[model samples]
Target: MWLPLLVKRLNQVDMQKKGLQLTAEEIYDINNASLKDAIVQFGGFCTGEFISKEGLLLTNHHCGYDAIAARSTPQADYLTNGFWAASRDKELSNPGLFVDILVRMEDVTGKVLEGINAQTPEAERAKLVSERMKALAAEAKGPENYVTYVRDFFAGNEFYLFVYERYNDVRLVGTPPNAIGKFGGDTDNWMWPRQTGDFSMFRVYADANNKPAAYSPNNKPYQPKKHLPINIGGVEEGDFSMVFGFPGRTQRFMTSEGLKLAVETSNPARVKLRGKRLEILKADMDKSDAVRLKYASEYASVSNYWKYFQGQNAGVKRMKTVEGKVENEAKYNQWASADANRKAMYGNVLADINKGYADQKEYTLSQVYLGEAALAPAAAKFALNFVPLQKALKENKADDIKKATDAIKEASKEYFEGFNVPTDEKLFAAMYQMYYNDVPKSQHPDIFKTVETKYKGNWNKFAAEAYKKTFLTSPEKLNAFLAKPSLKTLENDLIFKTVNSVYNNYLTNINPKLQAARSSMDKATRLYIAGLREMQSDKVFYPDANSTLRLSYGSVKDYEPRDGVHYSYYTTAQGILEKEDPKDEEFIVPQKLIDLIKAKDFGRYADKNGELPVNFITDNDITGGNSGSPVINGRGELIGLAFDGNWEAMSGDLVYDKDYKRCINVDARYVLFVIDKFAGAGHLVNEMTLVTTPSPNASTASTSAEAAKADVLENVKPAVDSKTKVKIKKEERKAKAKMKK
Candidate 1:
């Protein structure tokens, strides 16, 4: 298997084998903008694509969910029923939402490495690299409006400069209700055989001249350099698939000890802490619609990774990931010990990793608990923002006091709108108790001492008193204090004191030791990665993802996650009906959707079998930030949107499981059907450059690989009855055998 390229460019031969017909220059031509221009970092967290020449954008429903929730009211709940602009005038403007397109990339390794080598001290080397990077980035940025930055690759063994153009005037076009967009919710997030629509529509607006500018009524749809042609005709199993976007991060080179610590310690801590937090949030959300609306986005954001951590812990344990890493280290040690030069360069790498993790074990747990516990109470976190006010009042700087007062007053509206003091008070007590029990007593902050002495270890009473006394607990109380704006008032506040004590102790005591240990690990990991790269010089080494544009391609095929249990490559609308339960919030199907299914009203978007495809799976490597990425086929046509990954490979960020890691995507046809039929937004559909579905025999993995030509797959799966399950297992065995041959 070939390693993916660090840059967005692909190996032509490998791409051709995967059915990609586009040349490397065609995919990423700096002189003539190409496919890369259509892909953008969607609001810094997710990926999105331009699907029409008119700059109509498509991303995951979850990506735009916050904006939708923010704009919604009880009388007109866009998140509950869905939102579709009847005309351009009705489209919603999203402030602070922007898309960043990669303008160009240049390898700047030689310039960055000008004064550093194997012998340079790590600190000195870092200083020199930082100086060089700033100069290069500034020089490249020039007088242009583009954003430019330098990124290190291969554990800082190489560097590249990237330039980007940002468009801020993005607007909401349409979305399906949460019932469809987040069908299975937390229950089916990382799990496969999904039936979620998981898509939303937006458009980029530009000034009359077609350049990025602030939102204005005069702004028109920006014409894009290139936009993907949406293929309503679906994909088949073994078809070529390519995912293009900014994958967040992958730690494929983590040491055995490092993997062990995350599996046993860190991941469990996050899962436990977040579980308690979600429990409190969910209970309140269930009771009131206003509370639900206020905490919807925050809950989704927290629970998404809360479940991921649970799956990752189970996956790593099941796969014996640490054991495999231990075996790999043993092999590397043998190779290192054989030569004196290799021994000097690489012998201590494993030991350093072991020691580093061991030294930071307690600190790592405390860090996670502190962040989750101390910050769990929204008012406590919000109170820290007034520190500047404290400083200003102490110094008697009237100007600074006025500025901080105004800032806090303005911010307090948004803060208190979503905040519920009673809910947070419960979370405050529960999380504090969990943290105190989990983390050793020596690591506890001074606040814990106060809890013991002042409240006699009665955390509920302590939390209640804290909430009652702090002016920050309510907008009314906080606003009254804002009118006076004095340092003495804030300094006497218990919330302010509690935040300071925990934060100051962590900074003064825990952080320095943790940083020192982590620094040693960083140095050891870099040297180990460099040694490994040299040992396998002929093997291709793709850099770890660092929120940069990258292209990964693979065949779309089914996998048997375990014996006698096989999942197919795709899911259909029928699956939704099968899973629907009126009593269950996660699986509730809208009556309109059920009627559409009953009428079989899929129109041209339906597959040959006359059913609407919902989600499909692929082997392309992806992570958190890759959500909403375009899942294009061989001819660079948009067939689906990459949204989630199968649960069996939740440890993928740390270890790439080629066989079990599947990129789950919502089929492009389903997106079209929802916009055209469900939302009655044909105008939005009209803007897209829709293409005819391909001939049934156009391509497959075997033919594409044989012909040296592919990008991805479309296969219909049989129903999961007892007999069909047996057949799937038999076919999976045959497929595995064929691969070996």
Candidate 2:
């Protein structure tokens, strides 16, 4: 191999610090069209580094974990301790995860510009392009959905089309159990001193035909052309670095209004909703050891963000509204004063974007709620039966009776598990009391009197009747009375439409009103965008990551917490002991791990600081999408896997705090320690051609089988597959748009 095992590739040096932020393509030497195939999206994840011949595909650990977690059984712990197959036969399969390979690039610029161009109105353009892109995607037939994107540039003046191939050859290879993977749990999720290894391993399986195929025992791992070698020299301040992964989400660039709303109402509402869900999550997780283990990731995932929102909300609250008049007057005066700037395509900029922002605001805010309150809350109902059904439909109310009966009959079959009787009874009683207390009797005289006369303010009796009326009611009585099967089926159903209906009603009515304030703010966003464009155009700032593949760089730096707050830069074998509090669930260390800590045999895996630690913290700017990303140095050497940021940096969800926000990564050294020292698997370690000559006196005894994986950026090369070259011969354009200077 031309690439050495340890030495940083000379070509991979810090290109940016040499005053080269622009790619050769930008200077017109490299055609953007030629690179189209290299840019692709997978499971909403953007991908790069086409032709991964190294058989080693790099993505976020969280990206692979979902697949592994889906296949995980209680008997085999995968996420915490780590997974190493004795051979290929033991590899687990999952559907959701896939390593997308960008195979070809197609520049359909002319086709894209056929009906829409600089002259096209943004509204009409959106409509035309939406249909056009779908049509383009439809005309495609292949192993994967062909990704097509319309790139708008130079203030939306230019547009281009990018197409890519997605590979479904992903398989779980190895992973540490939850203990090491999710060390800090919810408490340390978004904060620094972050100790977590949010990484999962998977191998890409290419079919016998050497293309993506359905899962099979016969499939082989798709080797990539290049796999990053490990570099544990440890990143220091001012060192060049880059990250490559499927970052899930980022809100870096937004209308100041959108940012405000995020930092304010939207984030808070989500936090409140999640807070409620967590309360239940905590209870359920606490009660059962199996469920706790089974749903560890789900719980920690939410907790990570619960802290994020708390910090985000704090950032939002800390930002007091400035004087609108003064701010606007100054902004307007500045814009008006810049005659030269206004003359350059400024005439129609305002009116041109007037409706688009209006069109995109709700959708922008809608993005925030898609998973949390909207889906997660629904998933949380332990069983369908737990759904709080409305009290018996009145005999006189035929519509209500039929509605209730129909819902129960539908849910009774295959939908709900048995209702949680105790939880339901207690919850419904509290809910009924809360409802009765909040609304006036005068508003609903009939119902109020019924509530008063029968239940007589006794929440228990009221709740019991409602619970019985829905799922608990005997089928014989229920069928006789309401044209339905015995509702006994609902006793097992955890989901209830009654609860869903109420929740939807609240989301529908309350959200629209709340959304208007956000919409109004989105309209004023032009001012913000314009202000930002003016301010930061000189810096090489990419669009706030949209769960796309991006590179964020910073160095290892530790901070002094509040006077009494305790923290360390590289947690040691000792951190395991510091976290030995028995009462605190977050601090529970396994006995074996505690023993390891007590023994203090870090071996060669220990940093010069001498500790084969479990996890380490850093200040790299990372977020959801950045999860499982390989933290690399300026030489593009892998150092650690960015798993979580510190709690203080949780505020980084919306705002990137250079000072306080740090990317929490599972140090390469620790990852190696766990693999070698704890697992004692030498086979996996022997696979990697050892590249590094660590200090002979260093702690090799503590070093684990994962040492080969540590600082893994140098020598690994993926096996390459030769395929047909994508052919796109551009025809000369006569009715073409003029190229901008």
User: Best-fitting candidate, measured by lDDT?
Assistant: 1
Ten-residue region with minimum lDDT total, candidate 2: 732-741
Q: Which candidate is the best by TM-score?
A: 1
Deviation in Å, model 2, residue 723 alpha carbon: 54
Per-residue alpha-carbon lDDT of model 1 for 1-741, expressed as tens digits?
Answer: 122232234367777877887777667787886788899999999999999998889999999988888888788888889999998888899988999988888889999998678899999988999899888988888666688899888778889998888899999989999999999888888887888999998999999998889999999998889999998866888778889998988888888888888888899899989998999999999998888988898899999999999888888888889899999889888888999999999998989988998998868888997788888888877877888898899899989999999888887867887788888889888988887788888888888898889889888998888888889877778889988876777877877887788788889989999999998887788888998988888877777888989888886777788865668788888888877888889888999889898888999999766888888899998998999999988888999999999888998888888779899999999999989988888998998989886733444433745333211112223444311122354544455455457
Note each model's CA RMSD in angstroms. 4.1, 13.9
Candidate 2, residues 355-429, lDDT tens digits: the string is 444444444334344344333432223223233333443233557656666775665432223223444355455
Off by over 4 Å in 1: 1-10, 695-741
What's the TM-score of each model vs. the native?
A: 0.93, 0.68
Q: How high a TM-score does candidate 1 get?
A: 0.93
lDDT of 1: 0.84
